[model samples]
Target chain A: MLSPEGREQIKYKARKFIFGSKDTEGVGKLAAVYLLLISIGFVYLYPVLYMISKSFMNLNDLLDTSINWIPSQMYLENYKQAFQSMDYWKTFRDSVVIAGIPTLINVVICAIVGYGFARYDFKGKKLCIGLLLFSFILPPQATMMPTYVFYTDIGLINSIKAFIVPAILGQGLKSQIFILIFFNFFRQIPKVLIEAAKIDGAGHFKIFRRIALPSAAPAILVVFLFSIVWYWNESYLTQLYVVGAFTSNAGGYHWSSLIVSLKNFENSYNTARSVAGSGMVDINESIEMAGTMLSILPLLIMYLVLQKQFVESVDRTGITGE
Target chain B: MKNGRKTKPGQLERRENAIGYLFILPWLIGILVLVLWPMVQSFGYSLNKIRLLPQGMAKLYVGFENYSQIFLKDPDFIMGLESYLLETLIAVPVIVAFSLIIAMLLNQKISCRGIFRMIFFLPIIIASGPVMQQLADQEAASIPMMNVTMIEQLLDEYLPHVLAVSITSVFSNMITLLWYSGVQILIFLAALQKIDTSLYEAAKMDGGSKWECFWKITLPTVKPMILLNVVYTVIFMSNNEQNALIVLIYDTMLSATGGYGYASAMAWLYSVIESAIVIFFAVLIMGRKDVYERRARKYQRELKREKRLEKKIRKRGERNERNYAKQKAKQQRKGANKKSA
Candidate 1:
């Protein structure tokens, strides 16, 4: 019924169709897998990407669009300006002083208390442990005003003393108890090690230092890292106490924070820096964006570098595990 | 109950007591000086209307007036409580459902599971501390997408409250909740993996469909985790102070008025409510038992027989359909040949 040319054409078409099926199916699966991964990854990474983008833009540019992930031209000067704006050196110095002293105190006090909780049987052991958990749950806000009043009553307000005293006592009243880490890590050490040291005539202090403290180094490290981050990021309390005190001392301007400072900057910069009737400040956006970038840089850098330990602690201990 | 009987302490035990007290002295001293006395004073302050100077001067103690003002008079406190309830109501179920599905997906034998886990955990890192500000900004920007035309068209007519709820606090909080789902996922992952593979193998051997196996085997095994996730998500949602105390406290602090005392009262009240909610649901879930039954002998036999019948019917139906189609085609070919002849 068919000529040789027609028959050959039909066979050729059939062979071509059959060969394409395998490659097409493989490519289809790969595409779907790629699409799925990319979408989920994008959603997860979007915020960090946004932070990086905003950090580079000038303040005005930040508000000009919904988002500017890629700036047409990068302005490297925002970083320079943020350093100057925050009085970066002074803030950094003050931050280190405030955060460091408390952390040292927290480590020492928490290590001892945690050891007591872990190793010894005392009269109020159950009650004391219960109270510690109670303190943990007590929202810091509930206590902040009283704590403030208490500090003022004792002449501890507006100084590094204000931050350090609570921290030193393991009573900072933040959600975290540095002692929890002490409790966990201490509990893990073979009780016999401490018992053996005690029986050999090492007193409590000697045993805690020579045996328990060294055994709990990882927890100590974890707590130190957490405490430093806590003290550094404590902008609210710092703002509440420090901002009012410093502004009042200056006598004229009631300087608000950058959260509030942004509005002032816009008004001042627009009026002074704008070239006749341009109606917008030349670099206002740049400054604001740069300010936000600068304020958060120390935190971001520290987080990026130490996220491994930070996450490791949470993964291992479940945070609330006794 | 037995406190009346006083036992004599041995010398070694007394010595241990003295050593223990000495070791914990710094914390005791700190708590006395810093936490306790101030907390007591604040409770008194909550009862009074105070003027705050940099110095410790309390002008007057008006009994329970500050507490009354927050509980009886302040509309914002009430509104804040309602908003918190609304957020918890909307966000908790979504988080439970979303996380369980995600845990299931992660449990699949897929490449790059670690990457998915890390991505899921990224939000948690953002949830705490200074990193919150950037996360907050991104959350704000993502707000408008909740009002997408297609989503609106589908759900708007049916669930009008969804729009209002989703746009404001609910959407951002859901995003925050999504990050926190990592912990739940990890917990669920542990639960899922612990599930006896033999149960699944037995189901497969009996020719159970994937859907049936999931409902009959997987759901029952992970029931406890599902309950845990729900309770944790609810607690986390309530503890977000934005819906509770942040705005009130911040405004008061900035204004430098007597708002701190009232805010403290509100915080105290809200925490009580939150703890009550968590405890209530926790008790409810742990007491329930319908979810825990293993397969009965009769049920197992019935399931196996049904699955075999389904398989047999499917094979026969496919063969019959193919044979009928081939017969129809052959008849068409014969008709064409008759026409040609």
Candidate 2:
């Protein structure tokens, strides 16, 4: 019933809505973006998903080639075995302490040092700053042996002090990066703000505490989270320094972390398997996946809870622009 | 640094400097004792054959024997170093490039961007060495649907063998490599978000296509960030506990055959190589100036050149006048001599 001209106009409008015009985004582009993001996002989360699904599959389901993702049934035995083998409660306690105390010290010390570099001029500030960045590139492996010896000499080899001492001294895990982040962040604080505070007869420490530190919530949060994560993830150093993996220094000190236990899970599980009777099932992929899941479970929960803040922190962190 | 002038230190300036030092005193001492002193001690350790006594370490100096042993004698280190270098060379670029692409994509006007970002960044919270190892063992590090072998074969047909092998290795563990780029994506996103929307509009007004604007504007603005990401990627790849060389060093440190001395030497060598990689990337990316910076420099140079030309012309005119005066004086003197004659 429509005229030919009216039909053509309607067709053109529909095409424009889909294909887009010069000044507006079309549905086509949006669809393409979503498609790309969705595919890549799937690839990104594929490992975690695979880990989760595999952890629930029983031996029969895992051996079946027909089963790709979905398991025949939920299996909680993997978690139970992994829990016992890892000594979950004890190792979890150790991980918390090992990652917690140093993170706190690192945040405080790095902030103070970063603030000093940002706001002050000293005789050798440039040299100090250069060294600060240079340290980031210098591998911790380069200093591992001597540092181990030094810790041994100072009676910190097999204790939590091994981690805390370096942290208190502003040399914790990735502390250089944290300091740089703080430096970049605090630099953006207008000079006038500090000047205004100073004119009120406040001391330098008072000014930093009351003025500069208060507005730095975003950087502090980012550093705190990053520090905790890095410390928690660090198993090699933890074993070498605090856990006394070599057994020579394990006389009075008994420290183990969750990640370290996961790393040595096979050996520990074998040991546990021998101690238990032959009734115990042989270790399989499901149980191994379950152990991996348990190790990362805490961090995954933390991320889920604090994700909004964590994602937004990068924007205000000025990590790239500076 | 103020106004590019060096002012004399007043009493207040000196006092402020002291206060600044006080604020940073903990870090300064920390670096000196924990970092610098250990560095010196490690170098000393590398020169010796150390024995771990129950009470203390006994040292017998061996000069560069440990170094020579690493270069000439140790086969495990050489092979590990080769594979490490090969994998890292392939991995860093792939990670950084993927991160930049994702950053640009996320920068676009999209729905549920927060969820997408969280998905991308979830690995950072969980990707410890042990966890990664476990996932890798379960064959979870690769996409189930991806025919990695097809890609490997495709690469082999086109690329050199060693290169193809490393690329295939990268493909095999592609998810882990991609996971490593979470912070990098955040960094690039921050930079991309800071870019003014008005600039893109201006480019559009100038008849620039989206591709051209991306190449000409977006890239140039984020050039510094590329270098930052490269350096970060290099450091992360080298220092990650998953690295075989680090594990090798740790094992060497504890092994009965190779004592702390040999391990120290190996670590120093590895650290040197690591620093070289970082420097190489830094120089490769940092060598070029920004497009805007180059243009500004060109304008400044042109202005300086014009002033220099004006000054040269003025000087030439004055010199010509002086010559002319001298010639006129000479002619006048010649005429006076003729009159005297």
Candidate 3:
């Protein structure tokens, strides 16, 4: 029963709704976003996908260009070789201890120092903060030699104590950044809250313990996560200090991480190859990819489990401040 | 709370300060001993001949000999340093821009956003040195479809060899660069999220297109973040385990001929170069004030300078008047004395 003009107006409104107007997004834009995300996401995960696909391909499948992504069949032999070569169990345990202990120490000490900086009227506070930033800026290379000598002299070489001591003293890997994160968070706590606590006869330490620490969960989580990841991946410092690579008696106690072991995987794999009596295929791209996949398998699982926390962390933590 | 009248405010402040110092004492000690002292000792080591013996170590001062030897005798070091500088310079911008773009894209209202974020951030977890080394070795770092050789040939014709090589290397390292952008993406996204939605709405009300709104509104608000991300990117690239110079330094430290002294020199030199890159980028970003901001600042300076100049002129006039008045008084006093005589 509608007139011709009314029908045309209705059609125009529907078209506008579909194609977008000034206020809301249209289907076209959404499609574009999805397309871009998928393509980039594919590219972003290309190496990982390639690693997985290649790891599952045996010698024949790897050699055949026709077997690009899908293998002719699933293969497990590459993983077996990589696992044996990496000493997966021992290094995994050591990696946990190495990355875990320092993270705990870094979290606690950084929080204390950061809280002090945030909630104090101390003299030379600016100088202290400046020095903290300066240390963050100065590359570790500038201080590597002397610190190495000091660690060797103290008999901390080739042991976990090398990392633990510095961490206990609040000089862990990227400790300055963690301290800054805590400082930024702690600065936001209202002074009135602390004053009220003081009025209730709570001493400074009591107030910090009962009040300040509980409110800094986000900062602590961030510091803990980043510290562990950095420490786990730190082959350079770990090699120099913990493994005693250059010392007269090296590899005495045999402390190492998975990534560190993986760093020298070729040599280890070659040794293991000789011991295996040459039945294995020559070390090729597939095996190397398999070894990498093995090395990252645990981390990938962790990422899967903690993906939500890791993604939302920056948003919820306010780590990026004005 | 009970006996506050007896204690001076100074005493309370002193106690508070003492507690603060106690809290920070651990860090202070660590920085002094582990950081500052070693920095000094490392500098000293860089200027000496360090010998490893059965009983202990020996050192003889060689001054700038180690540095000169590195610069003059070692072509590889110079080439490595040059390439490091070029790569870092080119890579930082590309990484920053790429992250900023992705952050904006993610900032848009999209479904299944969490999955995309996880994919982008996946690199932070598994990009250990060995893993990256293996991937790069397998030629998996570059996309197989990129046709890098074609790009290389295309670039080689128009650019110098050094630039062409670095550009090609940058292009080839595109994926690892993407990996480096994860933290930066988070940073940019955080910065982008912080932009007040009303600003965009107002721009829309003024008939501003999305592009205009972005350039006029979004860019200025996140400008500080650009500098921050640049510095962060520079630092990350320099400290990354994949950096050839760091590996070289590590190797030099362990080698028989290179030893501690020569290695320290290399480390120091490398650090200086790294710092220079950071500073260069920092200055580039920080020095570029917005046009409006620049004008406003210049206007403010002019006002301040005008006030200061007026004060200077007035002070000079007051001084001249006082001197003239003093001279007239002296002349009058001399004439009065003469008349009295």
DockQ of each two-chain model: 0.21, 0.78, 0.65
| Local accuracy of candidate 3 as per-residue lDDT tens digits, B154-234 | 999999988998999988988989988888998899889988999999989999999898878888888888988898888
List interface RMSDs for the candidates, in order: 5.0, 1.1, 1.3
Docking class of 2: medium
Worst 10 residues of 3 chain A by lDDT: A243-252
Task: Score candidate 1 by lDDT.
Answer: 0.63
* TM-score result, candidate 2: 0.92
A1-322 in candidate 3: lDDT tens per residue? 9999999999988877767788888777778878988888988999999899999999999789787899888889998888888888998898899999989999999999999999997889999999998888889988998998898888888899999999988898999988988898989899999999999999988988899999999888888888888898888888778865556564367887888888888888898888887766678777888888877887789889888777777775666674
Window of ten residues with lowest summed lDDT in model 2 chain A? A244-253
Clashing pairs in 1: A58-A285, A58-A286, A59-A285, A59-A286, A59-A289, A60-A285, A60-A286
Clashing pairs in 3: none
How many clashes (backbone atoms < 3 Å, residues ≥3 apart in a chain or on different chains) does model 3 have? Answer: 0
Tens digit of per-residue lDDT, candidate 1, span A108-164: 778888887777777787877777765655555656777765666686665666666
Lowest summed lDDT across 10 adjacent residues in model 1 chain B is found at B125-134
Consecutive 10-residue window with the lowest summed lDDT within model 1 chain A: A254-263
Q: How high is each candidate's TM-score? A: 0.70, 0.92, 0.90
**By DockQ: ranked, best first:** 2, 3, 1
Please list the residue runs of candidate 3 whose C-alpha ends up more than 4 Å from where it truly belongs after superposition.
A1-19, A248-252, A278-281, B1-11, B298-341
Clashes within 3 Å, all models in order? 7, 0, 0
Ranking by TM-score: 2, 3, 1
In model 3, how large is the Cα lDDT of residue A123?
87
